[model samples]
Target: MDTVIVSSQYQIVIPQEIRESMGIVSGQKIQMIAYRNRIELIPLKPIAQMRGFLKGIETEVVREGDRV
Candidate 1:
């Protein structure tokens, strides 16, 4: 696991390797979530960039005859 130290100013610098692998660029918006006892950071992408993300997923589902 990667470790980071929180600065006195309550800021932490992301490591270089992690930043490069995650494609995290400066000024990019990230969502922070506090779940249980740990924090999670999720990169936020623009809506336009999210286009076709769900392509090729199965959309058909079997339904009861009455429902169908």
Candidate 2:
């Protein structure tokens, strides 16, 4: 496990090994999600990454086979 030290200035440097493994690049957007007792940092996924991902997930079908 890797740990980061919080400096008195309230700044932290993420460990290089962790950063490389997670493929986190400079200036990439991240999402901060708060769990019950912990915070999770998730990489922000653009809508383009979701292509064909949710094709089968069913939502309400509106006006099914509309009658002319």
Candidate 3:
């Protein structure tokens, strides 16, 4: 696992390997969430870039007779 240290200004630098693998570029927006005991950083992508992200997701759902 990769580890990072928080700077005195309360900022942290993402390692080079992780940045490249995640396609994170300069000035890209990232959403930070504090969940349970750890923090999560999610890269935000533009709507145009999110096209067909769920191309193969299962769409079948079992429904009750009345609902169907």
Candidate 4:
């Protein structure tokens, strides 16, 4: 795991290797969530860019007769 130091202003810069691997560009918006005792950052992509993200997923789950 990579370690980062928080600056005096409570801001931490993401490492360059991680940023490049995750395609995190400057000005890209990230969603931060405080879960339990850790923080999670999720990259937000535009709607147009999110198209077909779930393509070819399994959709054959059995359902109740009345659920449909």
**Highest-scoring model, TM-score:** 1
Per residue, candidate 1 scores C-alpha lDDT tens digits across 5-63 of 99999999999999999999999999999999989999898899999999999999999
Tens digit of lDDT per residue, candidate 4, span 1-68? 79999999999999999999999999999999999999999989989999999999999999999998
Better of 1 and 4 by TM-score: 1
Q: What TM-score against the true fold does each predicted structure earn?
A: 0.89, 0.57, 0.82, 0.81
What is the number of residue pairs that collide in model 4?
Answer: 0
Model 1 regions more than 4 Å off: none
Q: Please, what is the whole-model Cα lDDT of each candidate in the order they appear?
A: 0.93, 0.80, 0.96, 0.95
Encode model 3's per-residue lDDT on 12-52: one tens digit a residue: 99999999999999999999999999999999999999999
> How well does candidate 2 match the true structure in TM-score terms?
0.57
The residue pairs that clash in candidate 2, if any, are: none
Off by over 4 Å in 4: 65-68
For all predictions, the C-alpha RMSD in Å is: 1.0, 4.9, 1.5, 1.9
Indicate whether candidate 1 or candidate 4 has the larger lDDT: 4
CA deviation > 4 Å runs, candidate 3? none
Ranking by lDDT: 3, 4, 1, 2
